[model samples]
Target chain A: MSDTRTSAGVDNFAVSKKMFTWQVEGERSITILTAGNLATTQSLISLLDERSVSGEERDPSILHQPTMFQVARLVGATLREIIIGASETGQTSADQFGASIIVGGQIKGGKPTVFLVYPEGNFIEITEDTPYFQIGETKYGKPIIVRAYDPKMDFADAIKLLLVSFDSTVKSNLSVGLPFDLQIYETDSFTSDRSKRIQADDPIYQAIATGWGDALRDAFQKLPSYKV
Target chain B: MSDTRTSAGVDNFAVSKKMFTWQVEGERSITILTAGNLATTQSLISLLDERSVSGEERDPSILHQPTMFQVARLVGATLREIIIGASETGQTSADQFGASIIVGGQIKGGKPTVFLVYPEGNFIEITEDTPYFQIGETKYGKPIIVRAYDPKMDFADAIKLLLVSFDSTVKSNLSVGLPFDLQIYETDSFTSDRSKRIQADDPIYQAIATGWGDALRDAFQKLPSYKV
Candidate 1:
């Protein structure tokens, strides 16, 4: 889950789109969640789009990558190139072009993979020890995920976990806010079973936020009281 | 609460102090929690100590400040001055002098207040709308506080709340480790009733962390799972 809210110096909705996907029917499927400067991320995405659309042979587009690792490499390289170009053109410092992305999915017969691409053009793939990865303002919502993660967790439970995570982040930080873009791609499936935007007033979102808050309070009360 | 663990490319135990307190019998009491850089914070604290001990009478030391507001101002100014000096001496850039602090306590005949002092020598006080303040890796621990805070909460409950908050933070970030310094000052008492360091194997810390994790898993199970 990723929120649509974006802000600059003052509160303004300059950009909202932060989720993307590309699929080749039954051959491949991919999903990406992005965070950081809008212009830099958008440019990176646009570059990928332009490259894939050219349909030229030997293009380093994500669509043409043979494995998920290569896809991560292509994305990381494109992001770094955009940032370096921005710096060279006096757009901003390389550090000022800060952005991070979480890309996950399966491509054809390859096992599913998720990778977090960093600003330095280096990347790390999620492993069994760290089965899930988060980008952007990840800390606020991370505690619950760390405590409750299960390797065999079902899609429904995963969405609940993510919603609770996103909701906590939205409440604590202004940079990330409501109406998240959500997608779920089942293993071996070339398409997501669900892909939609969760609006502020969405019933499930409301329920999860309220339910989680109440449940936390209840759990807190159950803990042994501090010795006076 | 703050952890004692430290890291610089790798984890080690070079610094552990993260909390401090000062008191004037039957007059005022204050506690501070610091985060960011060790050098800047230690220098800032040392400056305050030197000024207070010099007895120059004109020194704007935090110990001599009549009100908590003035105390905050003095601390902020001291921190800013140290940062500026560090920059001027080619130690690092102004931004590289990054640090932040949380100061909270009550003065004689005054209601308790908490202030978050910024690196820029400016500060903001805690309000009824935001009753608590946190410094250093606050996001991982913030959701619990946001949900659990209450003006009328008892001292024991409040301590429980902070422990839970701190535990969550310690579990998620290696940079914020344990052997946390804890202190509690009740209203009208110029001295704390409880103050101690919680070691790595401290039963209370371990119990809270384990019990809270179990409670969260239980809570997750109770939430109506999303339909596939």
Candidate 2:
């Protein structure tokens, strides 16, 4: 899942897509979530897409990577190329070109997995012990996930957990907001379930957001009051 | 209230005091909370103390600042002086000497108030609309405060609220932990109640910490599950 809000400054936020998906029927599926400088991330996504569809190219494309590891490296290398290219023109410092990405999905021979790719062109794969990666405005939302995550939980439960996490972040931060883009890819499915763009007025989201506040207040009151 | 855990790096954290108070019976009471570069903050505190007790100095000290606003400015100016001095000595960049402070208290003629002092020698007073300021590791703890804060809440309820906020932060962050320094100064009283340093194994602290987790999980579970 990814939030659609992006901003150049605190006061000027616009809805912008930050998730990209690629699927080859019965073969592989890939989903990418991005956070950081809008221009840099957009450029990275465009380049990845162009390379995948471009014919007669010597450069390896994300679609052709043999493993998820290679796909993550490709994304990182592409990020570095974009940063170095911008730096060479002296348009901005390489540091200003930073972006973070979470890439995940099934790729034929590989089981479903996710990788957190850094701006420095390195990545770490998700593990059972740490099965999730969050890229932006993460702190407010993290406590719930850390406390509630279960590897055995169903996707519906996972989505509820995420909505609660997202609700917390959305309420606390101005930079993250609705509508959120969500997709679910079961292992070996090679294609996602009907992806969702949950808008601001979505009933379920409103329920979760408003319901959570009341529920939390009730829980807080139930806790023993602090004694002097 | 302020946490005692301080860290030079993620792997090396030590218990250190970050709250300072000055109380003069039936006259004035002040509390200062510090967050950021430990060495710089320590130096800032020492300098403020020295200037206050120097006896023959012309410069106004924290103890002598006539108003809470002036105290905030003094703290900001001292921080700027420390950063500039460090820069001039070629010890480190001015940016590395950054620190943030929250100063609050009641003076002889003024109503009780709080101010957030920035590293750049500027500050803003808290108002009814935004009655609290948090300096470091603030995000995880902020949502609770934003949700539950009530100016009319009694001192005990306020402390309970703060403990809940602190509990959320300590659970989420490695660099913030018990024991916490707490002081309560009632308006027009000009004297604080007995302060407490809540240690990790303190019974009340333990009960709240463990109890909050259980309460949160129960609250989360009770929220309506997401519908497909």
Candidate 3:
């Protein structure tokens, strides 16, 4: 899942998709959620798409990577290349071109997996103990996920959990806003049909946003008050 | 209320009080919560205390500031003095000597009030619409406060709300930890007996920490799941 709100400054924001998905029928699927310099992220994604379509016959692309880890590596390498290239031009420091990515999905023989790729081109796979990754204004939304996460949660519950988290973040932070883009990739199923964009006026999103606040207040009230 | 955990670096944490309080017999009371470079904050508080004790009889001290805003101004001036003094010495930049403070309580003839003093010696008072201020590690703990704050809440519930906020922060960030110091000042009462240090093993704190997690999970389960 990714939020569509892209910000250039505290007072400047626009709706833009930050998620890119590539799938080849039932053979393979990959999804990337990006957060960072919009220019760098867009260029990196375009490079990946262009390479997958026009790479030298012997020079394999992300679609040709055998495992999820290789796919993450390819993404990271491409990001590092863009940043390094920008730095070499003397226009901006490498830091200004920094970007982070969360790459997930299944490819042929490998099971569904997720990896967090840092700006420096290194990556870490998500484990059962730490099942999710978030970037760009994360702290306000973290406590809920830390408290409520369960690996056994079904897709419905997982999406609910994320929306609640995003609602909390959006309420507390101005930079992150509504119209969240959501995609649910089922294990071993290389399909892209379960994706949807949650607009600000979406009834279900509104209900969850309003309902979670009331539910939290109700829960807070049930906790024993501190004694004087 | 102030959390006692202080950090010099991510791995270097120690128990240190960050809250200072002053009160006069049935006449006035004041409290200051600080967060920043420990040396700067400590020195700033020390200056406040020293000046209050040794200033010329007619010079007037924080105890004689007449209003919470003046006290805030006094605190901010003291902080600026310390930072400016250090900057003048050429030992560190002004930013390195920066600190922030939250000053709250009642002075004689003044209603209970709170002011946030920035390092540059400016301040803002909290109003009915924005009833609270947090100085450090704010974002991880902000959502709960934003959702649950109420001016009409009794002191006990207010303390419960704060503990829950602190608990959420301590759980999510390593730089913040247990053993919180709490002080409750009643309006116009001018007494300071209602203070306690919440130790790591304190049963009530333990219960709130454990119970809040369970309560949050319960609340999460109660939220309506998103339909696919």
Candidate 4:
């Protein structure tokens, strides 16, 4: 094994090599692809923290204050604490020496955002046109997110969508087993009550688990198969 | 955040939860799924060291021998050592804390396996028809494995699928970045030489990345939109 260290610091939000493509109402909107590295996070935070010449950190005089790095730091710190606690208690195990966190939401006056947080206390926010967030072993669950996500989705819909996403991940990755803790807050509601921990045997989640697996198999069967 | 320390050990020829899953052909083939706290790495080593009916400790025998817990210890030790090294290099600032390992594979003549290695150096394997493995922010990348995994898949195909799976994960989770280290060995290959470090800018990977994202969007657009 190569001696590569898998630690994310404040400055190292490595953008995924993958490009994110989306089409809305027959129009294509492709943002320049970038990973959530420390530089990107810092730049974003700086833009968000910029006040019109006053130098006041939290200046309200500006019409739009961006989400600062401090905000990212605060969010990263919260997630770090959560994962640390989880690891200590044996709820979640780290792989190759790291945990994963997805922290996304709109800051006041900013566009709705999404970010994927590394175990090293760093983050990357998703942009508006592509408004969704995913963490853990996510590929098994990504198709659903791509198929179902909508910018106008209400918090309820978003939470359900996220649950489905989590369900897909759990089914595919045993390391990411439940009970899952989900929290969904409205854009402006800083404090919300839409958080729930869905256990492995939770009824609603069970329905989703069985329903989705069956639906996927059925869909696969319906698709054209390759000729031998 | 609940405190629950669950541990399991695989004895001589004994498989742990690290490598259990159901394989899908016309039916599901379950792999490993042993459960118990005392069944951990230390206990398994002790069990292996025990004398046979001849009152003499058996030599290291691969036949009917249990998978080694030393593998988990190695992975954990590697992670901890890397974290320490990174901290000394100023690449990590999080005080000597955080990290985990997911170690799993098959022992010769034993069932193929999987395990989630904790920071404390214990592990559990997966046994069942689910003949695959994953580590890191695995939640985001698991769906593809569930939908597309076939136990009889050629090693090439399986590795490709895993690459794509990892692609989805790196895209969705910041903690699991690349250049990714991937290794694929046939059941009997004593050494894993198929291993390669995947960087973000690799051309073929770039193609898969763009293709997957585009395919997802195309499929999404074709889906019937909900009438909210």
Candidate 5:
């Protein structure tokens, strides 16, 4: 990210990536990537089913159906090939391989799942306790998640929270400018149900951004200052 | 610097070498560690004069006075020697150079100053525009400064802001634990008039922290949620 870029302008230094997965049936699985690299993205998918990496000890009582490492390996290999091909064609680069995938969805008998895929091909799943995943300049929007996030929140609430989160991040960090690409998948749906690329001037997002900032300033002013 | 060490515990690390100088009059200086180095318990003094590092061209209209490179070199050399010696004695390590020296006060005709000395020995001054310096886990406390910091703020106000800043960081990051060493230096005062180690149980600090968190949560709740 160039230091010269101001917070006001929309500048894309490198691509930012994230993936999400949903499970429809006990046997069926689907993965979505912000940028296509199935091999690297698959590591995230496998993380969901892998119990050992979840920091959870082996306990039959917990009823863990581990994510298949074989699936992860397959995904990783595919992503490596895709990245290599993109590099050769000058469409992507080894250094510019920037993307974070949020993978979550139901798989067969198991409940719905979600995971965060890092650039280096490793992944961490979001348990029921920590239900959201954010990549790139996450601080400005974190307060919203910290306050509003609850495991029982429905998909609609999640989408609202995500938009607010992205809005705050975009305001604070120039590297994370938009047009933002958003994809929403319902549980049990193999296909992407809704997707949109939100531009900088999108009306709804602009409203949220302005409103959040003004609200923050007002709230701050209202807080009691130190009395010395 | 270890995560296992609590705020209440005494630091296991000890300084094995020391070098410092105190400015008394017109460039009057005395080297404290010209012979044998003092133990970690001995606090050293260092001066930052206009002859220090070269100043960046801010606005062409604004008068600039650069800090002396010699002062920076001396401070850096002393810190490096002490830190290395401590590490060799198994008290700390290259990575564990966590102490930060606040090297700022007036020198003759110059304004009072404040700086955060990095482990690498480099330093950045806190000017009127940027009025505070923090060495560790600065994120949580940043909002307070962003909202409250002003160049003309009184020293009392500055101290209050610093306490709030430190409070936020301590709450968020365990690595930046407290029993904080706070020193307040007034303008034109060559030596620190008030210096105190604030413990975890300090009542005033506790009240501010608890009050700030509660205020934040209250403000967040009052914000308008998504319309849809």
Candidate 6:
């Protein structure tokens, strides 16, 4: 989300870039959606990019990793390293450099998966019990997903559900905004199956946001009112 | 809200008490709904209570305030003082002392009003533009209120709206639990018009929670799906 709104002391509008995708196509692919501390995230991504193209022998880039777990570890380690460097002076940078990433995709023989990597270099994968992972400004949009999530739901439905989630977040938090970068990966296909950056005026996103709000009002009215 | 669920290291369950009411009958009245840290708020409330009943000079309780603005200032000052005191002692009570309060009611010959007091000792009163205030675990339930709130809404409808808001919050956050404390003050009557604690087994609350979920799922299904 873009930070189109802000209060007095806090601003997240500087960030419009929170999603990144890397793939070797037909082999393995990863998509990283980030939140928090732009400088730290940028540094982390640049370092990974440099290592990927540098052909350096001493260090292994995320692309060279064998599995999703390895990719998580590499990203986690790099994040910790960047944070440590940023915070070397004191707690200021440590606080300022905190970042989180959602690393998702599939490696060659593995099923498609998603993970939430924390600032501390530790991470957890989304399980069958919890099919989706969201980080940063997540609460406002959570209830819809909580009520509506289904493992068997089709990708189109999944996209609609997420748009509602993101729409809810965007409505409530000034820090999150459109256009949102969305990517889809098909199981066994080691590449981004589809992707789009939904702009603020995008027809589909507008429909979803307005439609969801209307639906909520309609739903609220339909509920049996508490007899006071 | 209560904490029935928690992740690895976060807990907001310390608060089962979030509603406080003060009324002098036909003269004046106020109800303060709090969210955020426990100790600081407890201290703030205790200070107000202490001053209210004390027979001392150099003290002005929240009741002594001439206007709701003054009342907001008093509460905000108390909150800021508590936070500063806690922070100064280096983690003794500071880390757990952050708090926020919503002060609302009517004063004799004055219009009914609401103010959201921040931890920083500042507050913004509710205006025609936004008729309600919510603090702590507020996001999950906000969209509903945003859609349903109306300045001209009857008190009965207002209560139902809030229940839905609280219901959404309770569903998404285990920290916000059942048996919620509620107080309603009629505009001219001053003193609390009505109050109730919706218990875990409260049939009405249960129905609302379950019905809301059902309504939401129904609403989601009704929305036009994306044509992928």
Q: Tens-digit lDDT track for model 5 on A131-162?
A: 66655455555555665566776565565566
Q: Which scores greater on lDDT, model 4 or model 5?
A: 5
For candidate 3 chain A, the 10 contiguous residues with the lowest summed lDDT are: A55-64
Q: In terms of DockQ, which candidate is strongest?
A: 3
Q: What DockQ values do the models have?
A: 0.71, 0.68, 0.74, 0.12, 0.15, 0.64
lDDT of 3 by residue, B39-147 (tens): 8899987877877888667555898887888888888888888888888988767998788999988977889989999989899999778888998899989999989
lDDT of 6 by residue, B128-189 (tens): 78767777777898877777787887776676777888777877876776677767666688
* Segments in model 6 whose C-alpha atoms lie over 4 Å from true places: A1-15, A91-93, B1-15, B91-96
Q: For each candidate, what TM-score against the reference?
A: 0.93, 0.96, 0.92, 0.40, 0.61, 0.91
Please give, as one word, the docking class of candidate 2: medium
Which CAPRI category fits model 3?
A: medium
Q: What lDDT does the true structure give each of the candidates?
A: 0.83, 0.85, 0.88, 0.46, 0.49, 0.77
User: Candidate 2, which segments miss by more than 4 Å at Cα?
Assistant: A90-92, B90-92
Top lDDT: which candidate number? 3
- Chain B TM for prediction 6: 0.88
For candidate 5, the lDDT comes to 0.49
- Candidate 4 matches the true fold with a TM-score of 0.40
Model 4 residue A184 lDDT? 47
Instruction: Specify the CAPRI tier of model 4.
Output: incorrect
Candidate 2 achieves a global lDDT of: 0.85
Q: Which ten residues in a row have the lowest lDDT in candidate 6 chain B?
A: B1-10
Candidate 1 local lDDT, B115-178, one digit each (tens):
9999998999977687677777788999999888778888878878988998898888777777
lDDT of candidate 4 over A83-166, digit per residue (tens): 455457565453323444344444554544456667667877666676555443446667677656778865555555666676
Number of clashing pairs, model 2?
0
For chain B alone, what TM-score does every candidate structure achieve against the true structure?
A: 0.92, 0.93, 0.93, 0.54, 0.60, 0.88
